[model samples]
Target: MPASTREAVRTAVLADSDTRWKWGALTARRITPESVEPTGFVLRGRATPTARQLTETGVSDTAPREVTGAEFLREVRDAEARGEGYDVVVLALVGGAVRALLQGLADLGLARRPVIVTGYVGVVYEKLTDGLLLRHGADVVLANSRHDAERFRAVYEGVGASAEPVVEAALPFLGGAPHTPEAGRDTLVFAAQPSVPATRAERAYVLRRLVGHARLHPDREVLLKLRSKPGEHTTHLEEFPFQKLVRELDAPANFRLVYGHMGEVLDRTDLLVTVSSTAALEALHRRVPTAVLTDLGVREALGNHHFVGSGLLTSFDLLDRGLVPAPDETWLARQGVAADTPYEAAFDAARERVAALLALPALPPVTPYYTAETAPGYLPGVLARHRLDVTAPEPRESGLRRVVREAARGAYRQGVQRVAPVIRRLGEL
Candidate 1:
C-alpha cells in the first residue's frame, strides 16, 4: 500500500525467458532487490525429465525452492504481515499452470498482488481458456499485435472484464539482426509440428503429401524441421514423431530431418510450409514466403484456426501440384511484426508497462477458485484436481551428464565381458 513497501515479482518460468529478462532489466531502474524484492521469482510447476525446459531457457538448475499450496498461502500472508507484499506478479506461464497456481493463491486469499498474464504462442486466442483467465484472474494481458490486442479486448468484454489491461507489446523474439535469407535457394522447410499429425493415420497422410510435393519439385530441398528430438516430451503430446517416421519413407536426397531451434532453422528456409503451426508467424517475421496447409482443416484434432484470413493458407494438394502462394500483404500488416515497428519503440512499450504496473499500489486481495473461471480447460486433469496443491521439480542432471553416465555403463559392460571366463573358473575352484 505504501511506496516504501512496494515489491515486484517475475516468476522465473522456463518458457518466459524473454519476458523475464525484459522486465527484469526494466524494473532494475526503479526497484532494487535490497530495497524491496524487485524480482522475487517463485517456481510454478514440475518439469518432465525429457523436457529440459529450464535448461533451454538459460534458467539456472540450482536454487529451486518448493512450497505446498497451504505453505504458499502462508508465505504470501507472512510477506503482507511483514509489510513487504509484492505490488505486481508477472506471469508468462506456457500452459494451464497459471490457472492452477492462481487457484491456489486465491484459496490462500491472494494478497493484493496484481497478476500480468502473457503468452508467446500466436493465435492463442483461438483457445477460450486464455479468455477465461483474463476475465477471472489476470489484471493485465499482453498482446503482440494490435490485431491480437483487439481480439483480447473482445474476449475480455465477452467475460465482463475491463479491456484496459489488454495492451499491445511487440513480439519479443521477432526482433534482431536479420540473417541471410534463404531466397533463390528454393528450399522448402516443413515446419513439422506434433499437432499436425496427432495420430498415425494423420502422420501417414501428411508425410505422403510432403514426399509427393518433393517429388513434383525435385530441384527443391524439403526439410522436415522437428520441434524436439525423438523422445522429448514437449507441449505437444506427439504419439508418432516425424523423426521416427522418416526411416520408413522411400526418401529422396533432398528429404532430411533437421533438429534445432526454429530461429536457427529459419536461417536457411526459403519457403516455409506448415499445418497452421506458429512457425508460420516466424517465417512471416523473417519475410519468407510461407504457406499454411489447410489440408487438415479446423475439424477433428488438426485445428489451424490461427492462420484464418492469412493469405498464406493453402492446401497440401496445391503444394503437391507444385504451386507456391505468396503471403497476403493485408495479413502481414495486421500482424505488426518487428519489421513494421522500430525495435526501440517495441522494446520501450513493454518496459513502460512494467514501469507503470510496479508503480501502482498493492492490488486488492482475490478469492481464488478452481473452476473454469480459475483454471483453463486446457490444463491436465491431474493438475486441475490438485490446483495450488503442487510440488516443485528437483533439479536433475543435464543431457551431457546423462550421456556420460551411459558411456560409463557401456565401458563397464565391456570390462565385465573380458573377465567373464576368469570369474567362471574362480567360482568352480
Candidate 2:
C-alpha cells in the first residue's frame, strides 16, 4: 500500500486519571507519525481529571472527550463497522480496567481493530506481576525504564506468557533544561504524594519536619509541592492532605504549598526531596540534587524501598546538615534517565514498533493471558467492575437521559471528592 493511497493514521487514547491521561496522550503523540494528531478520551470515573487538573498537566491540544466504558466500546465498534476505525488506541487505565477492555475488544470480533497500546504513568513500584499480566494483551506495553522493561519481561516469561509486547521507553513527562544554580534565590522542594504517608499522624509528622526545616533555614526557600488540592481527584486518593496538616503548624513565609507542573517547580529548585514520588526521577533526569527520605524508614509501604541502591536516600537530618547526594550513574542508566542520551531517541524503538504493527495486514484478536478458561474465578469480577459484559448487548440510551446521567455522575463525583471529605472532617471535629 502506498502512503498516498492509504488514509492518514487516526489515533485515539483512553485514560482513567489525570496522570495516566498525561502519560497516554504524550505517549500517543510521541509514537504517532509527525503528521498525525491523536485524540484523547477521559474515561468517566471518580479519578477523571477536572478541567483545572487537565489544564495544569499542560497537555492542551487534545481536548479530551469524556466517555463511559460502554460508550467508548460502542464508538469503536461503530467506527470499525463504518470502515473508519482509529489506527491506534492507547489504554491508559488501571490493570483491571485494561483487562476488562481487552475482554471487551476481544468480544467485538471485528475483522480489523486498532493497535492497542498501554503502559504505566510513572515509576511502577508495586503490583508488578498483577499489573503486567492485566496489560499483557496490548500490542505495545511500554516500560518506562530499562529497569522496568527487564522486570516486565521477566514476570511475563516467568509465568509462561509471551513477553513480546514489552517495550523500553523513558517516561514521556521527563524533560526540561538541566539544573543550573539560580542567581538570586535558592529553592528546596519537597515533592508530596497523595497517599504514600497515608495516616494523618505520618503526614503531620512529615509536615512538622518540613516546617522545622523551613524555620531552621529561613533564607533558603522551602516549598511543599503538592499534587492536588482538596476536592480535586488525582491518580491516588489523598486521604490526608499536606495542606490541611500544614495549617496546624506555624511556618515561615518561605515555606508554602505550591501546585502546578512538577517540571516547572524543579526549574527553580536547588534541591528536590520526596518519599517516593516520581518527581524524584524528573529532578534526577535534570541533574538536580535529589534525596529520598529515610525518616519514614526504607519501607515498601512508603515506596522509598524502590530507591534502595540509587545512592540518593537520606533523612531530613542529613538534608538539614547540608547533605546533597548525587544519583548513581549506573542506577540512572538502568532507570532510563539517560542524561547523556538524547531524550527524543528514547521513543525511536517504540515508534518503529508502532509503525511495524500498523503495517501488518490486520491485527489478530487481543489474546490476554487471563481468559474465562484461565481465570474463571477472577475474570468475571474484573469485567463486572468496569460494567463490561460481552455476553449481553450494550444498553441503548436517549440523548436526554445521557445528558442527565452525565450530569448526575458529575454531581456524585463532586459529592464524593468535595462534600464527603468536609463532612468527614466535621465528624472528626
Candidate 3:
C-alpha cells in the first residue's frame, strides 16, 4: 500500500511507552498529522507493567491499550487475510525489542511492507547491537546524526547487511517544545544512571562524587535526577539505590537528589554531568553546557569511551574546583553537534528521507512465512531465543529469592567498588 502522495501514507507505530512518548509522539506530531490516521502497537517486551507505568506517567498522550507480540501478529494476519494493509510500519525501540518485532514480521511473511526503524536515543559508543534493522528487513534504518549514520553504514555493511536504506533522520525528540529561560543557571544537574555503576561500591563512589561536588560548590545547586525509584523498572537495574546512599552522606545544604522532567531541568541547568548518558547529548543540543564524567574512563558497558575528547567530558577535577566547563567547538564539531543550534544537523537532513521512503514501492511479501528463524514465540521466549548466541540464560528465580540474589550481588559489587580505588592506585603505580 505504498502511497506516492504524502496524504495517503497510512502508518502503524510499534513502540514501548518511553519510545512512543519520546519519539513516536514526535512522529505523530510531525510526520503524520490528523489527516493521516496511523495505528499504534506497543512493544510489550519483557515487562507489561512498565508499559502501564509509562502511560501512567503520561508517556503517550493519545496512546491506545498496548498489545502483546502475539496480539500484534494476530492483527497483522487478520488484516492481510481481509486484504487490508498499511502503507508503512514505524519501529521505535532499543536493541532486542526491535529485533523481535522485525523477526516476527518475517515469520508472518509480512516483511515486504515498507518499514522505517527510527532510533530512540543518541548513543555515544558501541552498544554491541549491529546491522540490526537491515538484517531483519527494515526498508529504512534511521540515523539521528551524521556520525551515527556513518557508524550505522560501516557496522551494517561490515556485517554484509544490505546498506541500501539506512537514512539520516532528525532526532524525533528534538522537534517542538522550545525552551523557556529559567531563573539563574548555577545548577549542576547529575543525571543518575543506576545501571552505569557495576557494583554497589561503584554506585556509592559515583554518588559520593556528586556529594563532593556539591560540598565543593556550596554556591551551586546540585540536583540528582533519577530515572527510576525503588520499585520502578527503568532501562536498567538499580544495583545501589541513590536514595539509600544519600542517607549515608552528610550532604551539603544545596545538595539534593531530585526527580523531574529533563526539559524542565535543562531550562534551569547551568551544567549537566553524567557517566555516559544520552541526556548529555540533549543538554548539549540545548546548549546547556554539559560534561561527561570520565572518573570510570573507557568502560565499554557504560559506553564511557564515547566521550573521550568531547571537550566537556571531564573528570572530577572541575567538580572539586567548583568549575563548570563549556562545550568545546572542536569536540562539538567532531560529534557533529551543530555550531549555533542546540539540535543535531542530521535530524533536519532526515525529514524528507523518511517521507520519501514511505512513498517508495511496497516490500515483497515473505512468500514462505515462519522460517526456522521466525517461528512464533512469546515475548520472553522470543527474546531468549534471539539472544541465544550472545546472552546466557538468567537462572529462573522470582519473588524474595530473586530480590535476595540481587542483594547478594549488590553486596559483592560493594566489595568490588571498595577495591576499585586500590585497583586504580596500583594501576598508576
Candidate 4:
C-alpha cells in the first residue's frame, strides 16, 4: 500500500467502535489529537442514518451492554474505513482478545495499517493483538511498564515493532501524599491481575511464609487483598475466592482480609509482596517495604530495588519475622527511586528512553518490501490474499453492510498473519 493509503487504514481502525470501547479511555481521553497540544485535531464522528438517529435515545446506564457478533463486525468495519485517517487506534481489551479481534478485522478486509494499538495489562488479548498489529502495519505499540515493554520486545521484535513505556491512565500520585502505613499489621498486598502466570502457586508460598511469620509476631496483623473475582484472563490459578486463604490461615482475630485499590490499601500496608509486578514499582515509589521472590525474567532485566535490604533474589524473610522491613534507600537511589520524591524518576527516565526508541525508524523487514522504493512490491499479494466476500444483505439492511463485512474479514486475516510467530513461540515455551 502507498503511504497515503496506509495512513487511511490506520485512521479507520482507530475510529473503529471496538477500539473506542476497549481502549477509549486511554486513547481517546489521554492521547487524542486534541491532547497533543498545538496540532490538536478536532474529532468528527460520522453521521448516523436519519431514521436510526431519530429512534429514541435512552439515558445511559452504569452497566455495559454486550454487542452481538454481527453488530461487533459492523462497528469494526466502520472503524477500519475510518482508521485510514487516524494515526493511532487504542485497543482496550486484554492482549488475547486484541489478537483475535485483529484477525477478525483483517478477515473483513480492514488492514492493520497506519494506526498504533495500545492497551492495559488485564487485557491479555490486547497484549497479543498489540504485538501482531506492530508486526503488520502498526507504527508503534505502547506498553504499560518497562517490564511490559521489554516483554513486548522479546516476543515481537522481528515483526514491524518497537514499544514505549507509557504509564497507563493510572491514579496520578506524583505530588507528595501522606500515606499512613497499615501499622502493626503484617500485611502483603497482591494488586496485580489475579490471572498472571503462576499466581496461585506463588501466592500459596507467600501465604505460608506470612502465616509462619504471623505466629512469631503475635501482635502484628496480616491482610491479603484480592480482586472481586477471577477475570477472563485468569487461567490456571484458583483465585482467593471469598478470601479463602485468609480464613484458612485462621491464625488470629487481628488478621484482616481486604480488597480494592493498592494505593488505598497501601495506606495501611507495612509490606508489599509479588513475583514480578508493576505494582512493586508503585509500592517502592510510595516507600512501601517490598520483597521480590520470583525469577520472572523481566524483573531481572529491570534490576532489583535498592531501597530496604531486600534484593530481587531475596526470600519472603520479613514474613518469617512478622515485620515489614523498610527498603534500602541508598540502593533505591542508585536505581533512580528517590525517597524525597512522591513519583519515580526512574519511570520518567524510562519514558524519555522510550521516546527515543520510538523515534527510531522501526526495524524494517530484511527484504524491505513496504518502503518508498518498493511500494508496489507486495500490493498485489496484500489485495489478493486479503479479499473478503460479503454475504448478500437483506432488504432491511443498508447497502453499506457489504463494505463492513469485507473490512472485518481483511482485518482479522491480517491479525493472524502478524501474530502467528508470537503464538508459536508462546506454545513452544
User: Largest lDDT belongs to which candidate?
Assistant: 2
**Stronger candidate by lDDT (1 vs 2):** 2
Task: Report the C-alpha lDDT of model 2 over 146-184, residue by residue, as the tens digit.
Answer: 889999999999989899999998899988999999688
User: What lDDT score is found at residue 2 in candidate 4?
Assistant: 34
Candidate 3, residues 312-404, lDDT tens digits: the string is 667888667756666667766555554455554444445555566555576544222223444444345546644322122334557989679
What C-alpha lDDT do the candidate models reach, one value each? 0.56, 0.85, 0.61, 0.41
Report the C-alpha lDDT of model 1 over 330-413, residue by residue, as the tens digit: 777677652465644654555555556556666544432335444455445735454553244433769999789657644553
Which RMSD does model 2 reach against the true structure?
Answer: 2.8
Q: Which residue window of length 10 is worst by lDDT in model 4?
A: 40-49
Greater-lDDT candidate between 1 and 4: 1
| Model 4: residues with Cα > 4 Å off, grouped in runs | 1-28, 33-65, 68-70, 76-88, 94-96, 103-114, 119-136, 145-205, 230-242, 245-247, 294-313, 322-429
Candidate 3 displacement at residue 112 in angstroms: 7.3
Better structure of 2 and 4 per TM-score: 2
* C-alpha RMSD by candidate, in order: 10.0, 2.8, 7.8, 11.9
Query: Relative to the unseen true structure, what is the C-alpha lDDT of residue 187 in candidate 2, on a scale of 0 to 100?
Result: 93
Which residue pairs show collisions in model 3? 112-363, 170-347, 285-342
TM-score: model 3 vs. ground truth? 0.75
Ten-residue region with minimum lDDT total, candidate 3: 386-395
Q: Count the backbone clashes (under 3 Å) in each candidate.
A: 2, 0, 3, 64
